[model samples]
Target: MRDSVSKDTLSDVKVQQRERGTLWERVRPGSLLMLVATCVGALLVLSPFLLVVLNAFKSPADYSTRGPLALPANFDLGPLQSYLDIIDFPKALTNSIVISVVVAVVGVLISVLAAYAIGIGRIKMRTGVLAVLLLGTMIPQEALIYPLFYIAQATGTLNTIWSVIIIFIVLQGAFGTYLLAGVLGTFPRELLEAARVDGASRWRILWTVVVPVIRPTLAVLMVFFFIWTWNEFYIPVVLLNSQDAQTIPIALATLRGQYTVDMTVVNAGSFLSLLPTIVFFLIFQKTLSNGVTAGAVK
Candidate 1:
């Protein structure tokens, strides 16, 4: 009994010593270096955005004279107002929201259906289908632009918002198909088998079992789809001619002049353009983290 008590006391002392160590002492030098490197990399990545915020409210004179790094003399709303005047901020904002939401929803629906068929249906030639989807996603938008343009013109969707919306849904669905198909491929079959034994229809099992289990991943895909569609400049610029039809990126791009650009106004427009995606990511951040971790589990 005395020997056992002495061993227990020694173990307790060792644990206490570990707990009492300073955090810096506990963290290895390599881990500390990684932490510092991560912080620096994050700051470097954020520098452009920081510059935009800094200059967004500055006067033209203040920015040009003192340069982009200098602080603004006053929080001038002029640049923001100029952006609003040059482009209809509210109208363009509304168009972008509508297009992005539509694409996210429709894109996810198509992907889920394709993934279901490929991942769970045990379809023949599944490998061929996956290869096709992978190939489709790899094709650059530049290569497809002309064919898409011709189709849009043929269908009378040219210069309208629907053109871009349709383009993204088909394109984005390809990626989501590849991602979710892989996820569903590795999905535990026990739940599916149980559902089948319970006489559940394929559709019923999909909704009741499969969908609920993978919802976090779907949310992440939806958020990505929305942001990707929202940031689109090339497609919208080519397809949307009217100011009222333009999305925020295209609207901001209009601020650039031929020889010289009004950078203060451009920065203000950029901030406005970036705001929605940031807000969206913040809203879905928890789901995104859950999705990433869940994807790693199996």
Candidate 2:
């Protein structure tokens, strides 16, 4: 009887114990599994960056001889310099930066206004308005390409950087508005009431009270919008026909041939292209983390 009780206690303890060798506690079977899955996902997401950095320094001869997976015998900046010259990289980089920054700022403003109206303005048919914006986002860009192209041409903005920036501002704004409206809907009413009770106007309240409270979330949105616009390829490729107006993603595609691609040169350009966004993300990462958790805290 004593032996059976001791064995049963040990079994119960083992069953309740956290699964070892992983970072997460095994509160249930799902938690340990989720930890493993997250690790795999992080690695998959980071693999492309690793591959680009690895091959970017390799010479064309070395890449062809050793295949794509092997380590480089020596680092060479020749491919990096050559790729930069081939694509006139500085011009592309500058154009990309300007367009992304403009879109991010404008997009955030549009989202804030739209969200304010939908979330707190006591407007009629608020759900309808949100539904329309949601539908706009859901409609695949492929289906709207023709209409967008025709509009751009008619406006005489075709093949210009403005075309890309304008399109992204509208697109990004719609999504941001949809997302931010939800955030604003649950805003602290006591704060808004206190502001209004103190004789503040609506616009003043927004900029001073509401905007300041949600500034971290807005920063996250701006960073994401900037990155999204920076990575745009399809619309820019079609609309910005002029080589001078093309963004980095479009410029990268121009290097590929019908039959073959230069892996070394392309990787060098990819590595360079990846750097600015990485740096931008790193700078804003803390703000992003805070924004993500802000809603949970209060």
Candidate 3:
């Protein structure tokens, strides 16, 4: 009986050891390292925005007296209120919304059509056309700034919101086309053939079948374009010299004085400016994720 009990105990111990080893193998050391790396990367990426929010609530005296990374002694809304009042926040916000919306909607529309032509229609010289469009994306915006300025001046579009809106539409539309074309190219040809066999015109098929299938991609592009246009500084600053036509970014820049800068107030404005983009992403994050992964499966 003693020998049998000892043998049973030994077997049980071995079983437990095997289970523990299997669990460790499933998790693996590499997975732990990846998790740690992901956490560190997230912290690094969010640190700047977190600092902006933390400093925004502090008073100028507190911000100056204490370290920038330090927590605010007390929360206050006065600085943000003052910043808004001084900068004419409503006017700038309105201009930004209008420009961003117009650019996003119109640009996406143009892109969808162009993408359909090259990707679905499979027009002649399609490869060459796509190569040219992709090349446009590689060109630095700085290189075109001079030509854009000259063109805007000659056309009497200087200091106008339309100038900024039109420029963004053209640039963003090209990129959107490239992205959407890739997604559309992966679409099953059988679906298009079926639609064609059903006596559906190319336009009808695009609107009915293609649009529904690619709605997620379009949503992603619209959100990106809107956020980009809303936060654009360089083009708006160079083109919109007048205060009345300036967007939120240009308006925010005016918060800094030539002689003296208020770090707290600037932080407040920066935080407020980020609100729209944060809200937008929260609203469309699901669609954006779906769009990004849509083509991966098939």
Tell me the alpha-carbon RMSD of every candidate: 5.7, 7.0, 4.6
Model 1 regions more than 4 Å off: 1-24
**Per-model TM-score versus the true fold:** 0.89, 0.86, 0.86
Candidate 2: tens digits of C-alpha lDDT, residues 156-274: 99988998888999999999999999989988899999999999999999999999999989998998999989988888889988989988998899989899888899999999999
Candidate 3 TM-score versus the reference: 0.86
After superposition, candidate 3 runs with Cα above 4 Å error: 1-28
Descending-lDDT candidate ranking: 1, 2, 3
Model 1: per-residue Cα lDDT over 193-221, one tens digit each? 99999999999998999999999899989
RMSD of 2: 7.0
Best by TM-score, which number? 1
Error of 3 at 68 (Å): 0.7
Alpha-carbon lDDT, every model: 0.92, 0.91, 0.90
Candidate that scores best on lDDT: 1
